[model samples]
Target: MRNHTAINTFILLGLTDDPQLQILTFVFLFIAYLLSITGNMTIILLIFVDSHLKTAMYYFLQNFSFLEISYTSSCIPRYLYSLSTGDRTITYSACLSQLYFIYVFAITQFFLLTVMSYDRYVAICKPLHYVTIMNRRVCRRLVIGCWMVTLLLMLPLFILLLGLEFCNSNAIDHFGCDAHPLMKISCSDTWLLQQMVVICSVLIFILTLVCVVLSYVYIIRTILRFPSAQQRKKAFSTCSSHMIVLSISYGSCIFIYIKPSAKDDVATNKGIILLNTSICPMLNPFIYSLRNKQVKQAFTDLVTKLYSSQGTREILK
Candidate 1:
């Protein structure tokens, strides 16, 4: 549909065009989205209720959870509706909005993960100064700075996208409206937009990854200085989960943006996006919360407190 005509609506050719497959896809995505929502909310609630969990680490974790909930919600619900109802048409404004917020939140993920790495670095490499360095005011400023930076990074790209004319081809080959797919269908030359995306990707992904690597190097050195093997294992354990989460998140993102052409294989692109948007968010809660001993203890304590309260109320009655 690309011959110099403005497109009002786009049909998302989503993961599949098959009716049976659409039902299965809807079910799968629905369940995944539900789990992601539940898990992330649990993390946020646990951190908020448990004073012991209130630290720079959990503060970042709460922010990450909120971002994941917003990030996945941006696309999954629309995709599910399209699959279930067989109505894949999305308005131009709606598509652009989704694209905008997805990029916004995705960029925030990079920033937050970088911040988490720095927090770990301080906690492990400079334990004596950790509290002083990562104070409440500092953490708040860092998070606000992340969102501000993301807004600056995305505004130019949004303007560039606005200038492009979407002619006849209105069918997006993937599950949602991404920059690459939109560029492919645009009648205008996408060189500038492509360049902007590449530049920003490098700035966000590569730079943050370098920071995380450097932080870990210092962390490892500090851990090794500890005399006891048990101490070393305990120190590493604190960071191991975060590192795993970072790998999965960054690995998927790198594959998506580092490629010469993301739209070359529509099937592969959609599958990779599913992993990034759906699967990865779902994994974050488990990776950080379930595995952390403090979180488990907090959950147990909360449960016990609630139970005792209920028992007391029954006795009073």
Candidate 2:
């Protein structure tokens, strides 16, 4: 039997070892990270400042943008830093911390997406009661509930991971400190932890997916029943962006986490996860803004107001 010594740091085998690939990867990720921050931040700012965006839909969207920022920030920056500097060694505590935040932010996002689906459902199906059903107090409670539920689910796995001792192999075969990679390299018997991971993941995935699907089913049925074609078109426009975002989010996650074959293809999984972390977050704000008329209008109004104010200041000077 090999000696199992507790290690303070673990090495990350990043996306590629080729110097050229590393540079390309760094540049791509840097741009993606920059765009994601800028886009999501813009959404948050617009929602906060725009009076027209004070409804429940924009409120949920604002929270969702924040979650995207937190989730992407939790991992991508570290990976980019490693690719740039060749510093692959991450302290055990930092690794665990990364794992915790990634899971928390990601899981909470799933819940928030589910909630947003419900919000869309209410807005389309029960428009008369939408305001009463999704009041400010209820929205706040739902956001808090998502975070609480995530923490409860993650605490068990995180505590169990802390008890594990790493021995022979300290090289994680991924860019970030993911649970599966960490568990794979541990000397301890991780069967229980592995089961817990799968169970938690499957439970969250199945539950949230069911909620989203059901919400859309009702939403679609209601939209179809509209008497006028114009009304139907307008209703579809309201939620189409959300539907697209949902497809991308759920599709990527299902491929990465739920597929049995994913564990075997570590390299492919890494690529998919890179897209999930960087591209998806970067694309989401664009998706919402480009497809949303109200958001576009809000952006235009904000810019015009700023321009007029600047002109006034210049004249006064």
Candidate 3:
């Protein structure tokens, strides 16, 4: 066994350990990285520049863009670098920082989604009082609360990880320093950290899922009373996007960490990791854009304007 002090960097066993697949993996993830950045950045810019999008929906859209970018950026760059250079090694400090921020961004996303659900709930169920209920002050406070609370949640997890002694194991059997995969590297008995992770995971699951379920329940109950068919259709369309996003993200996260036992075998757990870190980010952009007509129009408008302006500039030149 290697000495505890000898462990300084970790060799990541990325998506596939097979060197033959590195180029293909790099190409695939690079495409995902491009789409995720471009789509989310466009959403953020749209929310910023579009005067019509100054409402609560767009405010939360901005937050989601920020979260998605931070979350995806935390891992994808490293994964892509590893794929391209065929260097999967990460220094101890770098890995620790990556792990910390991954959890931080994830926690932020959980609360942000919950806030979005509450926003939808108010907009739908309490339409008459929506403006007053979701006032500027209230919305700002809720957004701040989500960020602060997520930071708080990340503190204990980072401390717990720091205390662990990595005596021998240096291979992380995943693309990133995912909680479950990182835990496997601890040579010290990880019963306590695992338990802490389980409790934290459970809290996010229960808290966020309960909020979403309650919000949707209220929204649906109110929708049932809508007299107009168009109104009902609009309500369903609005909630469908949130429901799909919440389900997929939470589903992948739970599958990876909830069972605890399943996390031990990296080979089997690879699918779960892929969904949470890679697939979920990519899906968020397309899922949201495809389902929302306004966004589709906005995207088309952006593209058309771009090409039109280019042609004009060329003619003038």
Candidate 4:
């Protein structure tokens, strides 16, 4: 066992050790971060301004957009700074805060995705009762409940991590502070913390995945029973975008967190985290909007309104 002492700061090794690669990485990440922020912000603004989008589906989407923005912000700016300045040192408190938020957003995303699957299920399987079942009050409650439960589940884990003592090693092999790396660096015995993380992660993944799977199963069944081919196609289209997002989200998550041997593959893990934190968020808005007709129309309408407003302002001037 290493000597017990408090660690005041931790160094992130970041994506690469090559100086040229670091500059390239900074540019790439900056562009990706900008795209993610713009895309998600556009989705949120469109949903808010368009009365036609004031439905349960769009409501959940707005929440997801906000979550993506916050999730990416929690990790990417620090990473960008590290790449730009060659300074990978993060204060201890900042590391803890980042770790706390990473867990909260990640867990909340799973719950929210599961909720979205259920919403799709209700909309497809019980079309006649969609509005009645997914009422405004219920949607609000479900969103609130997802946030509340994720926070409650992650708080204890964060508190447990805070109690740990880090001594000799303060270098994290990844771009951001995560549970496994933090555990590996700490001098104190982390068996309890590790067990808690493993158990909590498994439970969250399994429970949410089970819910999504069951919901989709029913959804597929309901779609198949529809007499009209066009109707089935429409229903399937509505679901395909979500199914794609779910697969990618859960696939990356399972590989990163659930795999027993994941720790040994630090390079692959960091690559996956980069994709998850940056690329995936950047893709989400485009995936949903391009696939959904309503969102495209809303975007067009928004642009038209902006142009018209500009014309009106010119006339007044």
Whose lDDT is greatest here? 2
- In terms of lDDT, the poorest run of 10 residues in model 4 is 1-10
Off by over 4 Å in 2: 1-5, 262-264
Off by over 4 Å in 3: 1-6, 260-265
TM-score of 4: 0.97
Candidate 4, residues 83-129: lDDT per residue as tens digits? 87778899988998998998788788999999999999999988899
Give the C-alpha miss distance for residue 227 in model 3, angstroms: 1.7
Least well predicted 10-residue stretch by lDDT in candidate 2 = 1-10
**Every candidate's lDDT:** 0.89, 0.93, 0.82, 0.91
Off by over 4 Å in 4: 1-5, 260-264
Q: Please, what is the TM-score per model?
A: 0.95, 0.97, 0.92, 0.97
Backbone clashes counted, model 2: 0
Which ranges of candidate 1 are over 4 A from the true structure?
1-5, 260-264, 312-317
Give the lDDT of residue 40 in candidate 1: 94
Per-residue lDDT of candidate 3, residues 245-288 (tens digit): 88888877776667655434666677566556666777787887
Q: Which ten residues in a row have the lowest lDDT in candidate 3?
A: 259-268
Candidate number that wins on TM-score, 1 or 3? 1
Ranking by lDDT: 2, 4, 1, 3
TM-score of 3: 0.92
The local distance difference test score of model 2 is 0.93
Candidate 1, poorest ten consecutive residues by summed lDDT: 257-266
